[model samples]
Target: MNEPLIEKTSGWRGTRELWIQAAYGALLETGIDAVKVMPLAERMGLSRTSFYGHFSDRKDLLDALIQLWQSKNTGNLIRRTEAYAETITEAILNVFDLWLLPDLFDSRLEFAVRNWAHSDARLAAMLEEADIIRVEALQSMFERFGYDTVHASVRANTVYQTQIGYISMKKDGPSDPLAPRLERMRTYAEIFAGQPVTDAEAARFFARHPVNET
Candidate 1:
C-alpha cells in the first residue's frame, strides 16, 4: 500500500506560509468560520499547539488572511493596471485581464474575502480600502492616457463597478468559454475607455500576455 505523503515542517515545527495556505484553502472551500486553528491543524494532521507558534490566535490568523487578500489581489491589480498602455482602452483591457485570469488574481479568494467582509467590521474596512486602491489605479491609468481628472474619475468608477457587479452577482450553469468571454469583455473595455480597440491591437495584447491554464 502507498503511504500518505507527509507534510514536512521547518524549525518551529511548521512555517507561517503553511498555516496561511491551509487557512486560505479553508476560507475558499468552506467559509471564514472554517478557518479556525483547531480545524486547520486537524486538516494538516498536526495539533493545535503548532498553530499558535505561527499565529497568535484566531483573530491573528484572520488578520493575516485579510493582509494576504490586500497584497495578492489589490497590490497585483495596481501593478498590472499601472503598466505600459498606449491607450486608455488598452489600459482598461489590462485591468480586465487580471479579472479574467485566475493566475493573476484568484476569483475564488476574492469572492471568499467579500463574503467574509460582510460579517466583520474591520475586514469590511479593509475591503473598502482595497476597492479605493483599485479605482485609483484605474483613474491613474486614464489620466496617463490624457483623460482629464473629472472624466478619468468617472471612467474609473464605471470600469471598477462593472467588475464588482460581476463578482457580486449569482451565476447558474457553466460560464461562457474563455475566448467568447474575452471578446465580450473587449466590448466592455471599449465602452469604458470611450474609444475603439482595433482587432490587431487586441490580438497583440493577447499574444504578448497569453493566458496560462496550467
Candidate 2:
C-alpha cells in the first residue's frame, strides 16, 4: 500500500506525480468512487484547492490513472509476448513471466481498472481495445512459431482469456506452495503451445522468476 502523500499547509501545493500517485493508490485500494478529489485531498493531508495545481478536476486525475493502467499492465504484457524465445513453448513461458514477475504487470491495477470499466462506457471500450491488442500480440507469437492463423487465433485466445479470467476471479495467494503451481504452468504450456514443455525450458523459465525457490 502507498503511504499517504504529505503536503504542508504552506505554499507547497504538491507535485502532479504525487497527486497522481495518491489517486492511483486510492483507486486500487478502494474503488473508483473513492477516487474523488476531497477524499484524496483529505487522505493526502492536502487542501482540496491544491489538487487543481496538478489536474483540472477529479476526471482529469481518473484519466491519468487509466493511462497509467494501460502503460503498466497492457504495455508490459505486449512486451512480454514479443520477448525473445527459441521455441513456441519457451515463448509462451516468456509471456507467463508477466504473471510471476511482480515488477512487470500490475495485476492489482488491472483488476481495479477492469472493475471500474464496468460502469464507464469509455473505459469499457478502452479495456476492449487493450484486450484485443494483447490477444493480437499473443496470436502473432503463435504465428511466429509456424502455426496457421486460425489455429494461432484459437490458442492465443485460450491463453489470454484463461489468464484474464484468473485475474478477474482474483484467485492469488502469496503463501501458497510454488511446486505445484510450477507443474501447473508446465501443463498450461503443453496445452497452450500444443507441445511438451521440456525440463530445460521449465528450468529456464523458473530461473527468471524464482519468487520462491525450492
Lowest lDDT 10-mer window, candidate 1? Answer: 170-179
My TM-score estimates for the predictions, one after another, are: 0.88, 0.92
C-alpha lDDT of residue 42 in model 1: 70
State the C-alpha lDDT per candidate: 0.79, 0.86
lDDT per residue as tens, model 2, 1-214? 4345684767778889988888888888888998998888788877798899989878899999998888988889899889999999999999888876667877878889999999999999999999999999999999999999999999999998998887898754234566676678889999999899999999998787575553
* Model 2 spans > 4 angstroms off: 1-4, 7-9, 173-176, 211-214
The most accurate candidate by TM-score is 2
Q: Candidate 2 has which clashing residue pairs, if any?
A: none
- Pairing residues by index, what is the TM-score of model 1? 0.88
Evaluated at residue 155, the lDDT of candidate 1 is 92
| lDDT accuracy of residue 211 in candidate 2 | 59
**RMSD in order of candidates:** 3.5, 2.4
Residue 31 alpha-carbon offset, candidate 2, angstroms: 0.7
